[model samples]
Target: MTACLLPASTTLASVPIRFVEPGEDGSLEGLGDTECAYLEATGFKPTAGRIALLPDESGKLSRVLFGLGPSGATDRNGLLPGKLADLLPAGTYRFENDPDDGALAVLSFALGRYRFDAYKAGRADGQGKDGGDDVRLIVPDWIDAEDVERIAAGISLARDLINTPSNDMGPAELEAAARQLAERHGAAVAVTEGDDLLEAGFPMIHAVGRASHRAPRLIDITWGDPSALKLTLVGKGVCFDTGGLDIKPAAGMLMMKKDMGGAACVLGLASMVMAAKLPVRLRVLVPAVENAVGGNAFRPGDILRSRKGVTVEIGNTDAEGRLVLADALALADEEHPDLLIDMATLTGAARVALGPDLAAFFSRDEALAVEISRQSHAVQDPVWQLPLWQPYEKMLESKAADINNAGSGPFAGAITAGLFLARFVEKSTSWAHFDAYCWNRSSAPGRPEGGEAQAIRALYALIRNRYAA
Candidate 1:
């Protein structure tokens, strides 16, 4: 694998160094004569991610210097390291006078080093074609290297799932992904499918996915001790949304294959938790289905009974992500787990309010919300908080049923959707819902312009700290 991560032990000696900024006045506080001359010899000016090779007195090639942009670590820094991965002559190097957080720093380098070659036949034109040695990062040696590798691997797993097209990643494919992960971790998995969904009390999940040839299924994977703090994660796994009878335009359907991004995300988070061996009893519920336009497809305005025993009137067949989630969330709620989190690509409204880069998180608990925010920001996996406005509950009122799947009118769509899902959680004091846009529209350093993982990094941090401590 040409794009694999280089463990942090490689040497990057003789590389020139400079922080990229508007002015060239910042001094290298403590450097030897050789290092200082190399900097001057290279005429290194601060340009974001610009690498210049230094030379020795004997004229031998020396170290390289990379420009750090303004605001230091806070500047749109995701792909800064990635630039080095592609540009640097494959050699090991360590950051000098870096931040105290080794995990974040090391992870950033790994992310910068990420390359998506799955679809690439060969190196593209105008790209740096270095058959150089892998860049080895040098940490302070106090950090848990194994843990860092595990989390990075987990994020990669989520990325791989989301990056895959829907044709190859349907309901059955999702189950296989979960099963493989379970087998690796020594966990147990149970799958309920087809008519068994109705028999098992997941009528809403069954109704939404019944039209597709791929049988609708619910994946239940369990790990950890029975007495540990119980945590349940439910993800909306709409493999592809043809929008059912309501039908979306061809453009709308173009990326519907990424509809299961939420499921992919939670699976990623679950993988991190299990791989790290966090001290929490974890349960993952994914209701995998394809909302197709079959003759047997459930129509608009139909009343469907949910696992929570509440009747929901379908206002828009296109708003099908929340239906599968409702059933899965109810099942998760029944256990009254200490913490419940659900992730989905549930609304365009969320993207409209917060944009595609950030996920919108909704929760009734204030402290948990604050902590989640802190953790997300700390890892640069930011999430914006959306209110669960109680008044909007009236918007989902159904004349023929207990509730409507969608809100009245177009305003506050994200909040109203959150309120709808909030109604199903009978228990669980701390719950959070992340309306994520799992797809990226453009490519950046570590993050490619494809299926993306939102908020999982921050949530994973919060979970490990909350339960293990």
Candidate 2:
């Protein structure tokens, strides 16, 4: 199921999809007595997510009816209608009463069709047990089909990368994927891997990743004009986190494969920016590694020096994401890029605070924060701004090192993690840090239960308006 956003030239006889709310079926035009009676007899209340197929005189498939539930309940998730891509029978469909935001609904429908069947032993496109042909959505003239396809494709790439198991997606494989994306966009990519990271002054990244057999690496991609506004993106690319010497319980380790979700999301955003040929110079830095446990693993008490020359005490081995991001963010800060952003699955505290559906981000720049907040609302990609509490910096203080990677107290874990990162960044004019839980525990609307792309959509919109304007 590739893009369902077919061109307007698709001449197939399209089916009309009518959205019906509670007690609103009477408003549906051209509904004959038979159809009304059928609905009444069926007790169709038009509750949310309900779908009913109507047949015409000869019992041929006619219009499709999707429910809107009770009033005020329909538009909860802007992309709720995207579920139709997976639920509806394979055919061409168009909405007749789509009173909601048309663009998001349409885009969601396009994104909803994605299914990661790569690991499936013998599945081909449109060849699953319940699938025969593609379910195509007619592109509304008002909607930009190409842009919808572009965004969907980027999100799909991130989902794909994040969904892949660690056994198949180590540091080397992650580098290859980044390289491939760079090559496609004619961007220049440079990689510093293994012991070379030490030689290149990225000690924290090397320290966190050295225990794994697959060598650690920093995948860097640079694109666009030299003199344009410089934008740098840093992502934590821990392929898998074993929690190192302070090993995690089995339950905690179950979803460790998604440790690189931040990298996947940035690459997804990069794909969108590069594909659109945005005007600004863009740089992507991903410190790829696996925090594995072995005799060579950096111990909990170890103090590792960062690329920025700050010594960090390893308070907790599980807090390695911030370490890798620190070195990468430090490198990005050196150029004093106009904008620098780093994202990671850095803390479970963020999830505890905002839940899995919402991501937490920190930004000291008020104007930029306001702009990002606006775009996030405009796009329905929810992200909450958590304060980078200055006072919490003390939580990361260490006697043996400049700062500790993890906090001493249970409070403000997310804020302290942000503060830990802020220590390495100073030159950047505007910077933000995101702590994202890049997986959905349960399927909802356009989001499936597997790996997800968080915050990038809103960030993409912000960048487009800010730089490309």
Candidate 3:
């Protein structure tokens, strides 16, 4: 269930949350002089993540002070207020002054309150440790409370899906989740499962997923008016990649449940778009599968035909994400939508190059890349653009087939993978691929050490601005 962030009453009666910068004491301006002096004498210093409580004349709690690190810090994680959400006692709070980014502060607060106790005992009642806390944020006059709630709801949905264990989050479960989202928004859903994939010409999706006892499926959902601008989204939903016949080491397979993060992310974005009722024909395609190591698994050196009719030689069975995505992307491209986006947890190279915080996206369209970058900075959802590098196309050359599933060299693995997927996309279409690490390594202010949602906010901002009616 999604956590409630905004307060029921819009009137400002809650305690004020004052955000202070390092070496700044002016944030306590409205406080009683004695209370300010007491804070100072008690060794209170303005530093990031530091909080101080204020008391009234009768010694009852009055206001809160939170540190915002040094002023002019370039790399501020907007989720700082989220720390307060976790620490503050059950009560309502309101920012004394408008935050640097009101939307981010609201989002961070809601996200920080998230707890995934789905499988834990006593959680069947839908209550967690933080559930009883009546903590809420008074929506700022300038901020749209509904918009923030919508985006936060989407993020929570993605996190819940990504955090679920593989036992309960198989291909079928994923399809059901998609259906639920579509039904909630009055969208249409169509799923092609099992041998139907072969009949539907999604041979590559079938070839990679045939090994698992659970059937593989392609989840396609559509919403909005057909006459509007077309926006197609494709996500790689590798539910649990056991590396197929090649198999991963135990350490490498630990986080395999998050392999479907791409699928979760697209669904989150779709939710936001549909909720906002953007003037665009939206379609989401997710190739949901588990790459297990059963006897029927496709083996290295085997050739398989894709939906686009391009034959691919399997250089490594572990590189199964690109195979399933190939068929899905091909299907998405057939419509030649005005904007096409595909996101996946596709490569370790992306993590090495950009780390886990910043997602690496590839785009052939310079204008779209620029707009996305602009919005990324505005929203603080970071994404770095990598080149398509036409020269690297040779790295995927295969003598046995039209292309190879894995690149020839170890270097530029991310780029080569992008190049391989680029084969399935039409050159005339405006397409962008995001390689994201959907898991957080450690606990941060608003983000906990678990599955996370990335890149959706900036992309939503871009779409909302472009197709604004």
Highest lDDT among the candidates is held by which one?
3
The collision pairs in model 2 are none
Error (Å) of candidate 1 at residue 348 is 0.3
Question: Model 3: residues >4 Å from true position, as ranges?
Answer: 7-13, 22-25, 125-132
Candidate 2 residue runs with Cα over 4 Å from true position = 23-26, 123-133
Model 1 misplaced regions, further than 4 Å: 1-43, 57-61, 71-79, 99-101, 122-140
In candidate 2, what are the lDDT values of residues 1-469, reduced to their tens digit? 2456767667878998888777763656798666666667787666788887777777777888887677777355678788787788878888776546777888788667767776687754321121224787887777777777678878888988898889989999999889999999999999999999999999999999999999999999999998999989998999999999999999999999999999999999999999888988999999999999988999988999899999998999999999999999999999999999898998999999999989999999989999989999999999999998898888888999999999999998899999999999899869999999999898888887789999999999999998885
User: How many residue pairs clash in all the candidates, one count each?
Assistant: 14, 0, 0
- Angstrom error of the Cα, residue 177, model 3: value is 0.5
> What order do you get sorting by lDDT, best first?
3, 2, 1
The local lDDT score (0 to 100) that residue 312 gets in candidate 1 is: 95
Rank list by TM-score: 3, 2, 1
**TM-score to native of every candidate shown:** 0.90, 0.95, 0.96
lDDT of 1: 0.81
TM-score of 1: 0.90
